[model samples]
Target: MKQYTIGKKAAVIVLHQLCMILMVTGVFATGYAFRHDAHENIDIYTLISLAGLVGSFVSLAYMANVAGRKSEDDYTIYYLPIDKVYSDVMLVIFTLLMVFMGKVISGVKNQHFDYASLIMTAGTFTFLFDMAFIILYQSIVRKIKGNILCTHSLMYKGYELLKRVIEKKDIHTQKTKEIMRIQEALEAISEGALDTTLNVNEFHGQQKKVAEAVNHIRQGLMSSVNESLKNEKLKADLITNVSHDIKTPLTSIVNYVDLLKRENLENENAKYYIHVLEEKSQRLKQLTEDLVETSKITSGNVKLNMQKLDLVELLYQTGGEFNERFESRNLTIVTKIPSEQIFIYADGRQLYRSIENLYTNAAKYALENTRVYVELEKADTKAVFTIKNVSKNELDIVSNGNVDLTERFVRGERSRTTEGSGLGLSIAKNLTHLMGGKFEIKVDGDLFIATITYNII
Candidate 1:
C-alpha cells in the first residue's frame, strides 16, 4: 500500500511538471508566431497551452492539499541557520532571473524570427517556468515541514516560552497551597491540637520535607504529652493510696489519744505530753487531708454540686466565722459588703472551702494589729470578692520573687515555720476553677490581696 501511494504521488507530480513545461513551450511558440505575424499557426498552440496551464493549476492545488496533510514536517527543513541563508540565495537568483527575462522579452519585441530571437525567448520562458516552479515547490515544502518551521520561528519559540511560564506558575500555585496547609496545621498544633498532622504524600521536594518535619513535631508533642499525663496519673494515685493507708493508722492513734486524755491523769508532765501528741496528730491529719484533696483536684476526681448562692450572705458568714481568730491576732476585720444581694452560680461547699482557705491564709500571715479588709460586690456581669491584708513578714519572702503561689506545696514562708500545709492557695485556686470562677493573688510590698470572681446569674 505504501509503495502504491508513493507511485501515485510521483505520477501526479510528473504530470504536473510535464503540463508546466508544455504550457511554457506553447506560450513561447505562440508569442513567437504572433511576433512574426504567423496568426494561422497561433490558434492550436494557444488552445493547447491554455489547457496545459489549467491542468498545471489543478495539479498544483492537489499537491498543495497533499502538502497540507503532511504539514507536521513543514518546519523541519528550516531548523538550521544555513537553511535561511540558502533561501536568501534562492530569492536573489530568482530576482536576477526575472530581470534577465525582462531584458530578453524587451529585446525580442521588435526582432525577426531567427535562432538568436528563438534562443532568447526560449531561455526567458524556461527561466520564468523555473521561477514559478521553485516558488510553488517551496510553498508546498513550507506546509509539509510545519514542525521544522514551528521549531525555528520566533513566534513558535515565543509560544513555547509562554507554555513554560504557565507551567511554572501552576507549580508555584500548588506549592503555595501546600505551604498554606502546613501553616494551618502548625497553627492548630500551637493551639494544643496534637492530633493534627500534615499529609507528606501530598507534597514533594522541600515541601514534602517540611510536611514530614511538621508531622514529626506533632508526634513528638503527642508522645511527650502522653508521657507527662501518665506520670501525673501515677503521682496522683500515689498520693491517694498513701493518704488512705495513713487514714487507717491515724484513726487508731486519734482514738488512743482521746482515751489517754479521758483517763484523768494527775501528773502535769503526762498532761503536757498528751497535749503535744494531740496537737501533732491533728496537724498530721490536716496535712493528710490537704494532700488527698489536692490529689483529687489535680486528677479531676472531685465532683461539683453547682447551685445559685448569694455572695453577700456567704462573705458575711465567712467574715463572722473568722472574726474571733482575727481579734485574737490583734488584727481588726474591716468589712465592705454591698447591701444589695449579688447571686452567682457555683458549688456552695467548694466556694465555702475556697473562702475558708483564704481566711485561714490571712489569719496565719496577717501582721498583728493591722486591719484586714474584706469586700464583696457586683461588678458588671460578675460578682467580685476581694480580701486584702498586711503581711506579718516581708512580701518578697512570701512570694519568692515571681513564683506562682497556686502551685502544689508552694508556701508563703520558705523556712517551713508556718503552722498549716502549703496547699491552701493551691486548693482554693483549683476549687475556684472547678466552680467556673477566677482566682487571683497579688502581693504589693507588705500588702497581700486575694480576689475571686464568678459570673453572676
Candidate 2:
C-alpha cells in the first residue's frame, strides 16, 4: 500500500514537470513559425497547436497541485513517477504546431499574405502561456509550504531526542537574565567609585549579594523529602527507645505497688485494682516501645547487623526466660531443637527479643494445660525458628500477622480480652527484619505458630 501511494505521487510530479518543459519549448517554436511564415494555409494547424499546448500546460498545473496536496498529506516525497504518456502526447502536438506556425509566419513576412492576423494570434497565445506559468508557479509555492509543514511534524514527534535542545534554549534565557542583572550591579559599583582601585567593603558587599541571590531554592528538593522521612523516623525511634527504656522501671514499680496493696493496708479490693493497674501500665509501656521499633524497621531506618550464632542455644535461652509464667499456669514448654548448634548470622539481641515475644504471646494466649512447641532448624542457607501453642479456638479470621499487631493500641479479637500489649509480635517482626530475616504467622486447627527465619550468612 505504501509503495503504491509513493509511486503515484512520483508519477504525477514527474509528468507535470515534463509537460511544463515541453509547453515552454512549444511557445518559443510557435512564435518562431509565426514569424517565418514557413507553411501556406497553416492558420488552422497553428490554432490547434496553440490550443494543445494550452491544454497540456493546464494539465501540468492540475497535476502539480495534486502533488502539493499529496506532499501535504505525507503521501510521498522520495518516489518518482514512471508514466510519460501525457508528456509524450503534448510534445508531439507542440512540435507539429511549431512547424506549421513557422511556415505561416515566414510566408506572411515575405508578402504572401498580410501579417495583421498572425500578430493578433500571437498575442492570444502569449496570454495563454503567461497564465500557465502563473498556475505552475503557484503549485511550486504550495509544494514548498507542504514540505515545511511535514518537516515540522517530524520534529514535533521526535521530542525526546530533541528535548535537550529546547531545555538549552530555556537555560540560555535564564542565563541571559542573570548576566544582565550582574552587569547592572557591576555598572552601579563602578559608577559609585571614581577610580579603578578595589575597595574591600564594596568587594564584600558584592560577594554577599551574589551569595544571597544564588542560595538554594527552598533547600534541595530531594534533601527536603529525605529530611521529612528522617524526622518521622527519628520520632518513631524516640518512641521505641523511650518505651523500651522505661518498661523495666515501670514493671518494677507496678510490682512494688501491687505488693503494697496486697499487704491489707487498705480495702481488700484495693489489691485487685493495684494488680489491674500494674498489668495495664506494663502493657502500655511495652506496647509503646514495640510500636516505635516497628515504625523504625518499617521506615527503613534500622539496619541489619547479623553475626553467626547458635540457633539451639538462642531458643533454649529464650524459652527459659518464660519458665516462671509457664509454671504458674501449669503449661508445658516443649522443645524440638537439636543439641547440636545450628549456626546462622543474625542480630543475637534482636533475635532474642523476637523469641521472647513469641514465647510471651504463647504463654499469654495459649490454652491452659496445653504444651507450647519451640523448634529451630537449618534448612539450606536459612535458619527457621518456629513457636507453636494450642489456641483456645479457631479464630474467625487469621490475624493480620505482624503489621496490625505492631500498630499502637491495636489488639487481636480474642486476645484483647486477655493480658497483652498487642505489640509483641510487631516488635518481634521489627527485630527479625533488623537481623536481616523475615517473620510470619500461620494457624492450623487449634495451633497458632509464629515463625522467623534468618539467612545463613
TM-score of each: 0.61, 0.43
Q: Give one digit per residue, the lDDT tens place, for model 1 in 123-151.
A: 55665665465454655355345545435
**Stretches of candidate 1 exceeding 4 Å from the true structure:** 1-172, 396-399, 415-418
Count of clashes in candidate 1: 10
Winning candidate number (lDDT): 1
Q: Per-residue alpha-carbon lDDT of model 2 for 259-365, expressed as tens digits?
A: 77657656758767777877777766656656666667667766666678887887777777889999898789888887886787877777777787788778777
Error of 2 at 209 (Å): 39
TM value for model 1: 0.61
